[model samples]
Target chain A: MGKVLMKGNEVLAEAAVHADCRYYFGYPITPQSELVAYMARRLPEVGGLFLQAESEIAAINMVYGAASTGVRVMTSSSSPGFSLKQEGISYLVGSELPAVIVNIVRGGPGLGNIQPAQSDYFQVTKGGGHGDYHIPVLAPSTLQEIVDLTMDAFDIADKYRSPVIIMGDGMLGQMMEPVEFKEKVESKQFDKSWATTGTRGDGGPKIITSLELDADSLEKRNTLLQKKFAEMKEQEVRYETYCTEDADYIIVAYGTVARIAMNAINKARETGLKIGLIRPISLWPFPEKPFEETRKRVKGYISVEMSAGQMIEDVRLAVNGHAPVDFYGRTGGVVPTQEEIYEKIITVAGGLKYEHENGI
Target chain B: MLQEIIIAGFGGQGVMSMGQLIAYAGMIEEKNVSWLPSYGPEQRGGTANCAVVVSDQQVGSPLVSNPSAVIVLNNPSFDKFEPKVRPGGLLISNSSLVARKSEREDIKVIDIRATDLANELGNSRITNMILLGAFIEYSKFLSENSIIESLKKVLSEDKYHLIDINKRALRKGAELVAVF
Candidate 1:
């Protein structure tokens, strides 16, 4: 395959199209506006359906209903619009449907301006809607990773019969890069016997609902869902480590912030600081293995992000006081400069240079 | 080698397309590249800008603060990004719209009357290609042939007729910067 210079949002829509997402329902918003627009233009060429629903709520509900038929279906939006789709997402999970939702996060508390932000970290990782449910969350940094992970999101959703979320920021959505897409192929490799297509009369119509009137049945259902989530945690954990062989200082970051931390890690290494990084591709599973492996001989861990301190909580939990866990971030649509992150590492080191322990 | 560049101008000055040309050329040369634009309200209000990072290594932090090169097409863009260029970096400005000739002694500055020259070439839209051409000559980041190959990717098929003029504009800008 040859590389093409493409925008993140448009390429992401095509990424799903290649993964056989034939049904797309979404509302237009900044950053992710391009994705919905791309889907509207490209889906029909592939003999698919693209709907610009009246509202994000309506779009998500459309996804929920289409997903009942066991089709490759998905929707996308920015920060505030994503919040509107939370109830539908929770409903999709409760019903155990395979659906993909994308949130290209932006600044917010209200209708904040359009710029990159990671403020939705806790909302996405902790399950935005009400319930004891968790959606498989994939966080990809670059456009190439976005293509790879968007395809993975659909597969993970179908394989587990659970909802999936692609957590991206405005930066990831708006940026452009050279990306080579995976080749398109025939999909729908999962069994849809439990779908609501119709009754085959083998026994009777299958009932698909989160509502269970019987207390014992509800308990059993919840236990089954928990076990499924546990399996996802065990099998779907994805992470990458950079120069962490014998690191004294480790930075924990994900998505766009992870790339920024790499710049800092590279610079810090030049000054004789043993710095490394852990980039968690799957945000929900929270890649705890890297923290345990590096914190053994590390002096400190800093979580860099575009939020006040959401992922830092997960970092703290993963470190478990094995090493000092610190945070450095900027909220409200501002991206942290690489120099600021390098300074954070220096501050975390208490301005003291590391001694050459095993002089490499 | 890494080239962190900022292309800033008014909304319709081809600032984004200029950045895209460089990025696409970088991709043609098989280099790691990222192009991030300052999106939303600013495009409608006053100025528009985009950051381009072309690197031999992996590109990180697409938001470039200290740029290795800056090309400003208007006075406002000049005022804002003139001092942001790295020491010993390069600054290329459109002298027709930007009145400030040079302000920094640390960096090499090339002020070309891009708008005037583009007008002479009968299409003011090619003004950005001129500045882009000058940057290409100065940094040697990507070849003109690679840029021409990528032009076929960015321009719609209907506008294929303008590729030759855009190529001429790039050459004009490169010629102006060759002496400086």
Candidate 2:
């Protein structure tokens, strides 16, 4: 494959076009501002529309509006901005619209920091927007995955008839990498069955609304969505395991933090610590199978992240108390160093006896 | 084993391009590779950095923390990253941009005025190309022929004519450094 150097933001924009997304509505936010800038330059060239909405709220609603017509549509924003769009996101999820949302996260409980931070882990995976619904979240650590997964996310969203989110930290958005675009997939077979296109066949007028009067019917719809989510766990869960079979300790992380953790794992191996990494590419599915397998062999586990320790909860749940799990992080946009992780691994090795008590 | 590196500098100095060429050379040598950069805010008006990982096996991480080597094009970058290099590693700094030297004597330092050399050669834009020359000369990271052959694949079509000048720049830097 020929590799062309491209920024992650630009690549995602290109991926959007490749996915046949004809409408994009977004506002400028740190780390992800370039996605909009890229779409502004590219959308017109591909006979698409790029709208700079007034706010994240307006942008997401615009996505809602475009998605109603069953056209591929997308929007992207950073963490705090993403918070503002939650109301609209919940609506999209409830209404079951096929749209792509990108969260190139910056640090924040509220406007934290802009440098790369994975603090939005709980926010993205646990339905940060609102309601009891889930948006399929894909976490890409590299620029190429940022492009490829974005293409996949569009299809996944369309297949499930729901909103899909490509969630990542600032590092993924800001980094440029060599990426080769897939030969454009022509998704000409549009399903107009539920779309708000002009009425056809036996219908006088079709309505698409989240408001249901019957509780049982609503419960059934929600149950169906839950089943779809279960299917996602079966069909879409993805992760990469490095040296877990021989690992004494497995460092679990996602997005940029996972990339750094791999380097630390390599360094630790030199010092005779058999540390490997469990990088979750699909953050929501959580990749329970691999973690469950790794827990059988590894002495202990460490949750490495850019946040305080969000994904550790999920890691603990996946491992099911089979082994001990610990946490290490640098918050407020600071990333953990290889040295820091090495120290933690050494500590875990030194205190291996503590594994039975609290998982060193 | 794969070694990842981040080379940072001001725009127009070809830092990102230099990193790309190194990563591309690794690909040409049949090694798995990735070249990544901080482009949006960092590449616009301030400093720019690209992370390049070259590996014999599948690359798990594309970001570099303790790189085997670092190519610093300006003072801010040198001051920022010099402390982060692994012991006994290589740090190539642009002498024109820095007034201070590396603190660690164990880490080999090659001081080349790549900016000045590129200016003399017609465009300061190729300073990164000149530094890329030093990087190859000192490290033996890739064969000279391999680099020359891969330049066209990395550079844009309009900029392809400058390949000869860059090769010359690489050779000049190699001739100056006795890293071998």
Candidate 3:
């Protein structure tokens, strides 16, 4: 099929439908409203269900209910709205329900502004709700990636029977770009034999609840969940490397910020500087392998983000004092300009060289 | 080569559509394109703007801080964005609403009376199309034919009746640039 010009939010909605996700629940939030609006209009035509719940809290619970029925379900919101959905998300996690949740993030501490931001990094990757578990998080930088990830999110959620979060910022949700939707992949066959789809034929009644009241049983369940998370960590780490070989410095960023960092990298390269970029595709898995491998060769790492240094802590943990890790970011709904990033790269690179010469 | 442009105007002046059309035309030409609008509270009834980037290679940032060209449809937009154009960049302004000329000596500025021409053409809404026509002619980033074809796709079928006037307005804007 030919490529079509589409907004990122609208394309994400279309991709979800193409992925055979027949149920969607969401509330209205800036930047992410287009996704809900698109679903409201398109889902009904495809024999699917689209519901706008009274609030984000209700929307996520609806997703939980639908997912428990062994059907593909999804919900999306921005920062504040997403915070409201946290309780339901934790329940979905504890219940082992498969669902796709999208957070087209905006700046916030409390209704900060309606602009793109990466402030939700810690909130999302660290398990927002009260739980001893982790959800696989996918951050997409481009519109095409958004479509591909939205489709894959459903499968990923079903594969582990866990909710997968697709994280994007306001820019990704609002921008328009050319995208070609691929032919749908053959749906993966998941074992829904244990689903709570009513005790009709063969299997007897099955209960779908996260309430383990007993301490011993809860601990056992927690151990098993930990095992699943470990398995995911081993199998699901994904990242993209650009111009990292023989580089003096590496810039780590994700989502919209990564794209801007690419511009900085290219600019620095034009000035005969060796700068590279490591874009984390999966935030939960948090591709640490790149940093571990590149730490010895590079002088330092620059963690660029739209927040005030949340992901930098992850980079520091990965680096483990092998090299100095610097942070450059903008908060409160402001995006760092390309020139600003490039200047930082030059200053950091020069500072690293000076420190090496002085043996500091 | 990468061409970054900022199209700015009042809320109802179709500033966003102008950027979308340019980006779509670039895509039709098989180039990488991105269009990002200023989608804040100010978009309701205030000055609106969008940034468009077209390149043969992958476009890194969709936000254009320093643009290669700018299209301003109002006095406020012209005053705000005229200084942000690169030294050797191009500026296309709607002279009908904006009475003052850009004072920048480094950049090339082309003033087209798009609103007046659109009024003469019996439709004031196509002022953006006229300014877009001038922008394309001045910048030559995308072929005129490609832009016209893109318009056919961007406009809904019910709105196809106005295609003729839009085309005329585009051509008129281009002619104004040529004469200058």
TM-score of chain A of each: 0.96, 0.95, 0.97
Q: Evaluate candidate 1 and give its CAPRI docking class based on DockQ.
A: high
Where does the lowest 10-residue lDDT sum fall in candidate 3 chain A? Answer: A351-360
The DockQ figures for the candidates are 0.85, 0.38, 0.90
TM-score of 1: 0.97
**Decreasing DockQ order of the candidates:** 3, 1, 2
* Residues A1-360 of candidate 2: C-alpha lDDT, one tens digit per residue: 466667778888988888888899999999888899999998999899999999999999999999998899999999999888888888888888889999888877787777788888887889876668777789988877887798889888888888988988887786655688867656646465888888867787777778878999989888988998888878888898888878888889888777777777888888787888888888887789988777877777889998888999999999888888888898887768777877888777767434454643
Instruction: Please estimate how well model 3 matches the true structure, expressed as its whole-model Cα lDDT.
Output: 0.91
> TM-score of chain B, candidate 2?
0.92
Which candidate would rank higher by lDDT, 2 or 3? 3
Global local distance difference test of model 2: 0.82
Candidate of highest TM-score: 3
TM-score per candidate, chains pooled: 0.97, 0.88, 0.98
lDDT of 3 by residue, A296-354 (tens): 87888899999999998899889888888888999988999999998888888856433
Output the better candidate (1/3) by DockQ: 3
Kindly list the per-residue Cα lDDT of model 1 for residues A1-360, writing each as its tens digit. 788888999888999998989999999999789999999999999999999999999999999899998899999999999999989988888899999999999998789979899999889999899888988899999999989899999999999899899989999999999999756666658878888888767768787777888999988988999999999999999999999897888888999889988998999999889898999999998888988788778887778989888998898888887777777899999999999999988977745554432221
- Model 2: CAPRI class: acceptable
Candidate 1 interface RMSD to the true structure: 0.8
Per-residue alpha-carbon lDDT of model 1 for B27-91, expressed as tens digits?
Answer: 98889999999987663647999999999999988989999999999999999999899999999
